[model samples]
Target chain A: MSDKRNSETLPLAWIMPGALLLLWQASSSLGWLSANILPAPLSVLASAWTLTLDGTLPHNLGVSAARAVAGLLIGGGIGFGLGLLTGLSRISERLLDPTLQMVRNVPHLALIPMVIIWFGIEEEARLFLVALGVFFPIYLNTLHGIRNVDPQLIEMGRVYGMSPRRLFRRVILPGALPSILVGLRYALGIMWLTLIVAETIAAKSGIGHMAMNAREFMRTDIVVLSILIYALLGKLADSATKALERRFLRWNPAYRR
Target chain B: MSKNNGAALTLSQVTKRFGDTPVLHGIDLSIAPGSFVAIIGKSGCGKSTLLRVILGLEPASGGSVASDSDAAHARLIFQEPRLLPWASVAANVAVGLGERGDGPDGAAAARQALADVGLTGKADDWPSTLSGGQRQRVALARALVSNPTLLALDEPLGALDALTRIEMQSLLENVWQAQGFTALLVTHDVGEAVALADRVLLIDAGRVTLDQPIYLPRPRRRGDPAFAALEGAILERLLDASVSAGSR
Candidate 1:
């Protein structure tokens, strides 16, 4: 039954990735692909092991992680706050939504040059770009979710004598939660992308910087290891969000574990 | 818990307009405390609007509406159950208690209400898991949980199948009898009106064309001669109004 499938889901997921890794190792060991272009999986693992021993991998990873978390907190908090404001008040929406929509259409990474000019390659430069990247999806989705909540349900809440605060907490927030989670997932993706681009373009001490340094030295193994780290982090972020969805949206059959 | 909880409401010259279109025109009526009153009309005849205007859901354009109970003590059962989809049945029922809905005492009251509605085992279930009839029962429990002084029912059983509707009607009658709250039901079914209400008001073209009082005993039989007669008379008037409107 579904229980059995649930138990096997993790193993089932790793099967394809495991096979791909083996095939990649075989190709690299046989010299079918040159080491200059692509390093073997084992060599990448060896490089990762060395980086860990030297404290480079963990240090760069911690820095990248801290940046990502800070950006998410700053951007998501502001976006959600603004979304609640604009979604509830028509006057706020009229005043702010147009400007937000215009900014949303621009590729956030394209602001890299201007951001560097403003912050002079400081941590703020990277933080600004990543936060900007994470802002729109969360904001737009939050606003849309709030606006589309069933009006009838809201009316029912009011009739049931729910005060203004309880009305939002009990009715509006839960109703908009599913959509807001979706926005978080989208913003997570943009978070990684913005971080990678920003780190490569500026004086950075993160995974992207490590990869850039390896590329200059033609250490393709270390470079591939950094790429894999980004991939792993993205997967981890997605799983964390899914866990949150399961916890918060368990009342919804679609989200019930 | 007693008939003292029943809310008597009175409205005079109640009028409602949406933009240029008028939905209700000068509706005037008084509901006695603890009495079950059913309002019947064809679709768009403004029976629902009249109920809403009195309940303050839709503000009357011009009128005086007076109720013994404050708006907080009034509960409405919409045609759709309107249960919070993300909350459990118990939690949704507890919503009738407002801010205390998540508190332990509210949960206890919600369980009692659910038991009253014969849904004692489904408190943890989601609204999506319930049948349509069960969902409406949950809505009823939620409305009853707060011990409302006035309960406004807007064709609450209109969408149920015939058998479930009858079962729900009997349940409603039982709850009204036990709770002693003022019940205002709006429906198109003459049989339902006859079977449930102390008085049946017939509305046509935004006016109360008829107000017939029922002297039937508790748990009135739909097959009884008096019930049949009242149902028939209302049906005849309703059909006549429909025909007259069509021709015009």
Candidate 2:
């Protein structure tokens, strides 16, 4: 019954977007909308099909995806490690949190110029920018999660004679996971946003670069296709995080349904 | 159900203070093995604080809190279930076993513990899925899974409604009888202390002012005049303590 209700409403969600696409297609085909400004959705699809056949789309997509994953691993790993450090130890939090808080306030995008100069427009530059963009949300959320774990539960763990490591593993980590996963989903959005801005400025190959290259030749179709690709990739990232949440937090009622 | 010998506890002039404020002032008490004792007091009367010190969650600034059982064989159930939200009920129950819980045998032990609390077929259920009373039962199971010689319960049923509180009091009595753990329950309710405890201690002004023994037999009926009289006397004593403390 729930499945039937979902199937009915899920189609309703698509109606507005479908209508907009149809309106755009009709206006472009009737010459009311010019190709130079915004090409019809079909022409964008055609460009995507052509790019796919030539292998450029897949190759660039793969490159961009690799960068996102690599940056997430490096940045997210460090953020988690640092979050643990500060969360578990008051001394560590006192020593490091203030500096991190100050640095966190500065927009990560503003560091791009310095990053380019330091890495000389190499892959490191884009990776560093993307990684920097992804780091703090995960870090802050992790710290908040750990610090806010019910103290009563920790006291119960102690009274039950749980070893320090076991207490952390069984109680603290799982307690913090819901918040950390929230950070991850937020970071995924930044992953694509950071990559888009990063790639457009520096990189030789990626969907962003394809759009940048298309701009000089006035191929508005490819530009629109690139934006669409980013949109689809962002949606894909959200779905993947939702899958992870379902797997990791099956015990949580919010995630179960 | 397998029963273990309950641990004997002896507190010799145990004093605990946080900063300048005194919580427990030279508390001296001896708990015999295989006995059920309830600690009852008004709010902020330090009964819960004493329970924490006895359970070793907090240290006594002076004197000693000693138990015959191994420190590993002691467990506490808080007012909240304190179950790991991300863990299944069986896994949460297994947490009582400490390091032993990591082993395969712990699985069967956890299931048995669940059954001990009449929580059959709920081993895999999340704490979030259970009712308040059921979750508290799971907390009881977790404390029981280790076959604890000393069990500390700090107002474990304080949040439940009246009917569930009565249900849990019987469950508590049954478990204490079967397992023979030295049960130390800290509660605010006079009737609960009378119903479940072999002896009830009332604290006021940071001291055990009234140490009363309830001579009523097992499965004592709440409707009995004897039960009501005992409850009323204790309630009067508690009110008297709080009122005098307020005047002072």
Top candidate by TM-score: 2
Chain B TM-score, one value per candidate, order as shown: 0.97, 0.97
Summed over model 1, clashes come to: 0
**lDDT per residue as tens, model 1, A1-257:** 89898888978999999999899999999989899999998999899999999999999999999999999999988999999999989999999999999988998887777897899989999889888888898999899999989999999988777788988998899999999999999999999989998888895699999999999999999999999999999999999999999999988888875
lDDT of 1 by residue, B1-248 (tens): 33346999998999888899888889889899999999998898899988888888888899889998898888899999999999899998998887776789999999999999999899999899999999999999999988889999999999999999999999999999999999999998889999999999999888888999999997888888988887898899999988886787
Cα shift from native, residue B61, model 2 (Å): 2.3
Task: State the lDDT of candidate 2 residue by residue for A1-120, as single tens digits.
Answer: 889999999999999999998999999999999999999999999999999999999999999999999999989889999999999999999999999999999999998889888997
Off by over 4 Å in 1: A5-16, B1-5
lDDT of 2 by residue, B1-248 (tens): 78889999999999989999998889999999988999999999999889888877788899998888877788888898888898999999988877787788998999999998999999998899999999999999998988888888989999999999888888988998999888999999888889888899999978999999989988888899999999999999999999999999
In model 1, what are the clashing residue pairs, if there are any? none
- The stretch of ten residues in a row with the least summed lDDT in candidate 1 chain B is B1-10
For each candidate, report its DockQ versus the true two-chain complex: 0.82, 0.84
